[model samples]
Target: MGEGNFNWSNEVLTRLISQAGLIALKLVLIIVLFFIIRALGKKLIGSAFEKYQKKNTVNAGRIRTLEKLSINVFSYALIFFTVVTALSNLGVSVTSIIAGAGVVGLAIGFGAQGLVSDVVTGFFVLLEKQIDVDDYVTVGGLDGVVEEVGLRTTQIRGFDGTLHFIPNREITTVSNHSRGNMRAMVDIGISYDDDIDRALSVIQEVCDKVSAEDSSFKDGPNVIGVQSLGASEIVLRVIGKTENGMQWAGERTLRKRLKEALDVNGIEIPYPHQVYMEKKADI
Candidate 1:
């Protein structure tokens, strides 16, 4: 009876050891396969991304978005296949697991309807070429330079050095400021007492000087004579068209140079002043 008991105990221990070893071996194989597959997948994806980047017809932002999406999709598919294969090797029934996963997925999908919508809209935005990375744009009352266009969010750097992360779905209207030539305008207010012809001549001379000096002055610092006659002064408008994204710089330079020239030419930029009258009090 004792010998029988010992034999039974030895058989149980051997079976347990064999099962554990099989599981360990399978795990090692799965890990090895995962890395091998991952390396190959990355190589394939990288090559495709490079090709996409090289295509001049495609925008850079679109290329980057597609590349990231491709890599993510490949990784998720690989993981799913690995898990299913590992389970199958362990003699687990996959059909029931798949059915259970489908139910869970349905619940998740219902909860993530907005997220799905955002992703879909982002894809359409890329396809439609409405905007791109590095574009200066105004969307949702916020104006900024686009730093990144992502799957669910867009990053914009505002002039005040603030970074705004905007949801893809919230971007309903986009006004691309850097798409074409931008207008550079400066309104110079001159004292009403000053000679209009003299003021106009001084401004024209300055505009000619600026046009001769700066290649960035595209159309002109041409004077749009007498835009407004304000209470204190007559406003003369200097308008020019400049290359997109260079308007602010051009405007700033033009203003500075024009101010200095006006001061030298003795054309006054008028400021608010009031007149006082001394009269006898009414009886």
Candidate 2:
């Protein structure tokens, strides 16, 4: 009986050693497969993406995100297939496993509908070019420059330097500020007593000089004439079209340069004032 027990222990030890060896082999093989998938994906899918980016002149941020996403996706695909192959080597029936997975996936699909929708929407966004990295946009009440666009979400950096992560599915309407030329608007205030025609002429002269100096101005920096008569001033509106991404800068420059010009030319910009009366002084 002791001899039999010794033989049983030997068998158990041998089996344990064999199982450990197989697991180690599988792990090594999986690691190799992971790298192989990454290399191939970069050469194949990533190469295609790179070419597309070059052709479309897509921003670098989008290109990098896409390349990374592609490599990861391929790595996962390789891992899945490698595991199945390893299982088949160990006498596991892949057919039965696939069948089981199909059912499980169907159930998970129903339960994770929102997640699936987000991924689907993200893919569409990438393919359709509805949005791209570096695009200044307003979406879902958040306005920012797109930092990264991913399969599940979009990242934006606001003017205030805040980073925002927005789910792709939640982005219903997008206002792309960099699509075309932008408008620069300025309403110059002058005292109501100042000559409207002369004030307009001065403002127009400033606009022309600014436009000529800065090529950012795409269209007329024309004076649109009097917009409103305020409490103590006449608001003369100045309008200009500037190249994409230069609107804000142009508007700021317009204000600074116009103010200086007005100041130099002695244009009277109005200030709030009050008058006082004394009955005794009048007598």
Candidate 3:
């Protein structure tokens, strides 16, 4: 009786060890397959975009934006399926769990409508080409350069270097500034006493030089005559159409050149001033 009991106990122990080994082996295989699939999926997505770009005259930035979106979608789906598979491998009844989740999700769907709206809105935004990565845009009352556009949120880097993640549904109106030629306008003032005709002539010479030399300027940087009469000066507005994203730089260059030209011609750019009078305490 004792020998029989020992043999039975040993058999049970061996069976449990064998089952444990099989489960471990399965987990390892599952993990390996997950990594392999993720890598292959990203590689395939990138390859497809490159091929499409080569065959079409599509905008390079738009292609990059779509490529990133595709990769994000692929990764999200792959991770979800991988987690489900891993859970099933651990002896969990995935089918029953999924059914239970479906009921819970249905109940919670109303409160989560914003998520669905975000995804839908994002889809249309991408489809309509309202904005793209690296675009300077004003959306959701915020102005910034778009870094990424995802299903849930779009990333914006502000001029002051703040990174913002805004939901897609919040982007009701999009003002894309990087689409085509941008207007560069600079308002420089001269003293009310300075010669208007001389200032205009000096500015026109500058404009002609810029139009001839600066490749960024697509249209006139011509002096647009007097814009306004300020308290101490006459404001002259200079306008130009320049390459997208170069407006600020073009304005800076204009201001510098205009200042030099005005100074060389003795046209004083005015500023606020105060007159001081000394009162003697006792004479």
Candidate 4:
């Protein structure tokens, strides 16, 4: 009887060890598969973006946004499936766990509604092409360049060096300034005594020079005659169409050149003057 008991005990120990080894092996396989799938998914996304860029069929910013979103979604999905599979291999009932989670999610559905809305809105934002990564836009009353468009939120970098992470659902209206050529408008002011025709001619010469020297100008820097007759000066307007995001630089360059030309031609820019008269009162 004692010998029989010893044999039974030995068999139990061996089975336990075998079971543990199997579980460990499964866990390792799960981990390895996760990494493999993740790498392949990312590589696929990169290849797609590269192809799109080469073809020039889609906007570069749009391609980049899609690539980033795809990679993120793929990684999340892979991780979730890997965990569930691993749990099931370890003798856990994944189906039951998922059902329980669903019940809990339903109970908290109201609280999670905002999160759902954000995801839905983000999906639509990407689908509609309303805004793209690196595009200058005004959304939610904030003007900035979009850094990233994630599933839940968007990151914008403001001109003042502030980074704002806004929920996608809150972006009700988007004004994208990078979709087409931007207008560069510069108003030059000269003293009223200056020759209007001469000033216009000098400005035209400067505009032509700028248009020739800079490749950013897409349309004319043509003068629009006198814009306004101010109290002390006459304002002349010059306008040009420039590549998106190059309008400010073009405007500055044009203004500088216009000023130099005016100065060389003896045109005076009027400034506010206050004259104080001292009358000698009969003492």
Writing each residue's lDDT as its tens digit, candidate 4 over 143-162 gives 99998899899999999999
lDDT of 1 at 147: 75
TM-score, candidate 1, is 0.73
| Candidate 2 segments exceeding 4 Å error | 32-36, 39-48, 51-79, 82-94, 271-283
lDDT against the true structure, per candidate, is 0.84, 0.84, 0.93, 0.93
lDDT of 1 by residue, 1-283 (tens): 9999999999999999999899989988997999999889988887887886787677665566566666667888899999999898888999899989988989999999878888887778777777777788897789998877766777789999999988888989989897778899999899887899888888888888888888887889788799998988899999998888888898898899889988998888988678899998999
**Candidate 3 lDDT by residue in tens digits, 153-188:** 999999999999999989899999999899999999
lDDT of 2 by residue, 1-283 (tens): 9999999999999999999898778778777876776676679986788789879976766686677666656767787877887777677899998989989999999998888888998888888777777888998799999877878888889999999999988988888887879999988899876777888888989998998999999997888998998888889998999998998899999999889988988898777778898667655
Cα lDDT of model 2 overall?
0.84
For model 3, the local distance difference test gives 0.93
Task: List RMSD in Å for every model shown.
Answer: 5.1, 3.9, 2.0, 3.7
- Per-prediction TM-score to the true structure, in the order listed: 0.73, 0.80, 0.92, 0.84
Model 3, C-alpha of 79: deviation from truth (Å): 1.6
Clashing pairs in 3: none
Candidate 1's C-alpha lDDT?
Answer: 0.84
